[model samples]
Target: MSVLRMQGIEKQFSGVPALKSVSFEVKAGEVHALLGANGAGKSTLMKILTGAYQADGGTISIDGRQVSIQSPQDAKALGIQCVYQEVDTALIPYLSVAENILLDRLVQSKGAGLIRWQQLYAESEELLRGFGFSIPVRMTVEECSLSEKQLILIARATVQKAKFVIFDEPTAPLSTKECERLFQIIDQLKKAGVGIIYISHRLPEIFEICDRITIMRDGQHVITTETARTNMDEVIGHMLGKSFAEEFPKAHVPIGETLLEVTGAKGGKVRHADLSVREGEIVGVVGLVGAGKTELARLLFGADEAEAGEIRLKGAQLRICSPKDAVDAGIVLVPEERRKEGIFVEESVKNNLSVATIAKWSPLGFIRSGLEAGQAKELVQRLGVKTADISQLVGFLSGGNQQKVAIGKWLDTDASVFMFDEPTKGVDIGAKSDIYRLIGKLVEQRKGVLYFSCEFQEVIGIADRILVMFEGQIVKELDREQATQELIMYYASGGE
Candidate 1:
């Protein structure tokens, strides 16, 4: 059987150590989970393996023979592939699905002859069909949904016939059905002797699909064990370097009069939906992908204009035409696509934390840098945002830290209703704890929070109440004590 192994892997970024003497190996036809919290060197190790970054020191081997992988081409030639979570950045939006799937083939065969478009589309269609998916090969990637984009990446990897494939948070954007499809593809790959390296923050998925698991912590290998030998609590403890008890950190904050109320709100994919968030309450909106949860948040936050609805804040009617109007009306949303829409990644953490409320620090139409810095420092500490200082670019931080900055930016605003759509989508367990605690603190301050997410378990843990959306409408509401995963799925699937 083929084997891929890396021993004594070491890497540093700007003189800061990222990976320290890490070792990992995977055998052909086995699903091996490479797991760690964000910034825990798992990504660093994978980058070195995929040739995105070279290790400062390490030895890599395949089937007991040392191999050199200095670039992505070298890795690809050696039958290695990676399916990253950031699908849009990796895909060509204007290209047809077939072209994107066969991109490497086109690049390799450049100037060979006239491209046979029909044959290419036919091959792509067959490939997708082989995987039991029905994505239109002729459709432009831009027209495909987020989940479809993820599948395209997976398909591209399979077409490459990779010996070792790494799936990084593959289910982050996928629906239940799409996730099952992905699992089938993984199963097929395994049966064909492909080594699968799966990485995700969801413990349930890991326990379900992976055969063996490797845990990393603080740039070092913690343990490698058979999946059947460890439990979720044990795995989480190893990942966090300590025993973790409060996974959700939900606290009791007395619910008060309604702080924000929406009636018949309609926008993009959102139909006439009604909801309310009381002071010191967290009301969760849960749904599968394309179920209009995000659309509802967008309309409430004025990211999209409402065609018809009444949004009242503290019993005062507000006309919100745009995001600015929503912010001015004391409503703010931390969007689902945090990198693209929630925060400016190119800017520093301090700047990101202050941008939304810069006007408050700038009485003379010029921002007081000192005051802004001070405020940022406080928020960073409050939000537990890990950075080399507030001036570090937010793009350099881990997913969880970046998310903290995204939510922190709006803390200074006069927004009473804070809307977070999938705030913990890619965040890890430790960071998720911090975020949940932050939400608790927000509610303690009597700030009504609208937590929109597909992670029903998380919502059930942290939210006092839950609203399930189906298609473009809210179909059911359940208190935390009564909500269950099965019930949420039933409502999300349009049950009466």
Candidate 2:
């Protein structure tokens, strides 16, 4: 059997240790789960394995022979492939699905032959069929939904037929059916003798498919054990270096008068919707994939145009033509696609945290650098954003920390309504608690909050009331006391 091993892997960023002498391995035909809390070095190790980042010290071996992987091309040449969670960075939006799937092959044959469009599309379609999913081969990736884009990335990885594959948070954007399909695909890969490294925060999935699990904490390897021998609690304990309490930090904030009201809102996939949020109340918008929850959030935030609707804040009708208008009217949205729409990844954390309220520090056409830095530092500490310093690039932070920055940007604003769409999609349990705590603080301040997510249990634990959407409309509304996972799913799937 083939084996991929990294012994004593070490990596650092700007002199700060990220991974310290970490060791990991996977054998042919086994799914290995890599578990860690955010900033726990899981991503750093994977990046070294896939050659996205060069390890400062370590040795990698494939089937007992040491190999050097300094770049993505080097990794690919050595039969290694990865399906990263950030699909946009890996995919060319203007290219068709077929083209993106066959890009590597096209590059290898650049000067050898003419383009074979028909054969290419056929191969892509065949690969998609093997996954038991069908997406139009000719459709541009930009037109695809996040779920579809994830599928395309999986399909492309399959086309490579690599000896080892890495799937990073692959199910974060998928529906239940799609997630099951991915698990089946993993089974097939295992039967074909491919070593798979699976990284995810969903413990149930790790137990279901992974044969062995490796836990890391504070940039060091904690433990590696057979999945059957260990429990989820043990794994989480190792990841966090402490026992975990899986509870939403929902505070007891009394619901007050309605702060924001929407009537007959229509735009994007949101055909018709009416909703209301009261001060200090969290209104959860729950839906299955493509059920228009995100569309509704976008429309309310003015990210997309509202074809027809009445939006009122404090009983005053407001005309919101853009995001600026929404912000001006004391409304803000933390979008689902955080890397793309929320924070500026290339900027420093201080700038990202202060951008939403930049006007507060800028006067007479000049920015008060000292004041901005002080406020940024305070917010970082308040939100628990893990970074070396405020000057560090936001992109270097872990997924959970990046999310905190995204939400923190609006915290200093005078915004009365806070909307978060899939806020915990890629965050670990610990990070989720921190985010929930932040939301609770917002509620304590008597602000209206909207929580839009497909995670029913999360909504049940956090929201005061829940609204279920189906077929681009709000089909049902239930108080928190009346909400259940089954009932939410039933309405989300268009139940009568």
Candidate 3:
């Protein structure tokens, strides 16, 4: 028997349909996969299911009984919960882990009274222990790593005794070991008869963990079948409405003389790392989670001070004291955490696009509104950012569009070298293609790029040369023809 079902689900926002005649169902003890590209209404459908949004038209049934869910509280009462991809927003950073885990329970049990601090901590500790997690109950959520926070969200859902749980892109920030642990937890939940709705762009994961698959495209249901019955190509075709020819489009660009050279760069987790990128070259840096990729990128971007290093740009020694110094030296970094470091979420798309080049649009100590808007508009159209208007808030856009805005803002600068740290993280396949095309365009324009990624295939697909880092140092460098997934993994894991 199905534990949950929805039929003819229809939703529209601002006179445009976000979902259309969608139907879905989940059975007890089943891990059902939901697949879709960005802006294809997957999130909308999940929102409706979790009662974050009321469906404009649909019939929702729980245990064969039709019900109306008007709020998140109602969804909780009906035994539903969701773990969103944006973990930072989903969690209360300042709250203790114990409080966060039992927040709803504490509020309900207190209701105008002081929380039972001892009892709450004890219970939360036991709960986390049962899940094989050893996180300190009193530690602030802000102090935890992304993977730990993700596990806490799962524990919260489990504590709620949810019959149906929706996990949206939960593995995007996780390491391989953490992901394996998550898979184990999901197995436990499945064995406990809980229904799981898993959403991810990683096809291999879907096949490994999901029993059934439902593909959605352009806000409509396309296909639903058992995971064993469908292949990756078929699933990609369904989600995109056509067969995808190449996952990565690596363009051929001639490499020129050295553009930026780093010798014995030491800062943060990066120690004694020497690297160089030539003009028109895409240099991929591959490493494990703590292999110093991000730290190295930070040093290059001037986010962290290099204690001892010589940075040469265009054959001249350069000293970068701050991010502005890096930018002024023709080096710009598209950060890994787009929402936190790369964008001003509260600002309009226009403001975000023109932020880096505000001086270019302003002259004589005066701001020119017309020139700013025109420039932002052109870049918006050029980058294919989907927004109703340039004045729209950047936070409201999808992950892919938000990323485009982040990269677009830097394009206005005359930076000769660009460093992209996990540029395609949390984005869908279609958006990834767009980003790859953009990277190709950058290299074709004779600009150098430093591409850092945890995904080996991405490095192999986009990079002209690959550098594998291990334990805060570069262990090996390979040309594109010499780099393979096996070889990269060997060096990334500190193999001899």
TM-score of each: 0.97, 0.99, 0.95
Residue-by-residue lDDT tens digits, candidate 3, 27-64: 99999999988678888898998888889998999888
Q: Once model 3 is optimally superposed onto the true structure by TM-score, how far is the C-alpha of residue 389 displaced, in angstroms? A: 2.4
lDDT of 1 by residue, 1-496 (tens): 9999999999977677888999999999999999988679887798899998899998999999999999989999999999988787789999999999999999988999889999999999999999888999999999998889999999999999999999999999998888998999999999999999999998999999999999998889999999999999999999998988988898797899999988999888998799999999999999999999888988877778789989899999999888889888889899888888988889999889999988878997988999999999999999988677788898778888889999999887778989999999888899999999888888999999999999988999999999999989999999999999999989998899
Best by the TM-score measure = 2
Global fold similarity of model 1 (TM-score): 0.97
lDDT of 2 by residue, 48-103 (tens): 98888999998999989999999999999998999998899999999999999988
Best candidate (score: lDDT): 2
Clashes of each: 0, 0, 0
Candidate 1 Cα misplacement greater than 4 A, ranges: none
The predicted structure with the larger lDDT, 1 or 2, is 2
**CA lDDT, every prediction?**
0.91, 0.93, 0.91
Q: What C-alpha RMSD separates each model from the true structure?
A: 1.5, 0.9, 1.8
lDDT of 2 at 148: 94
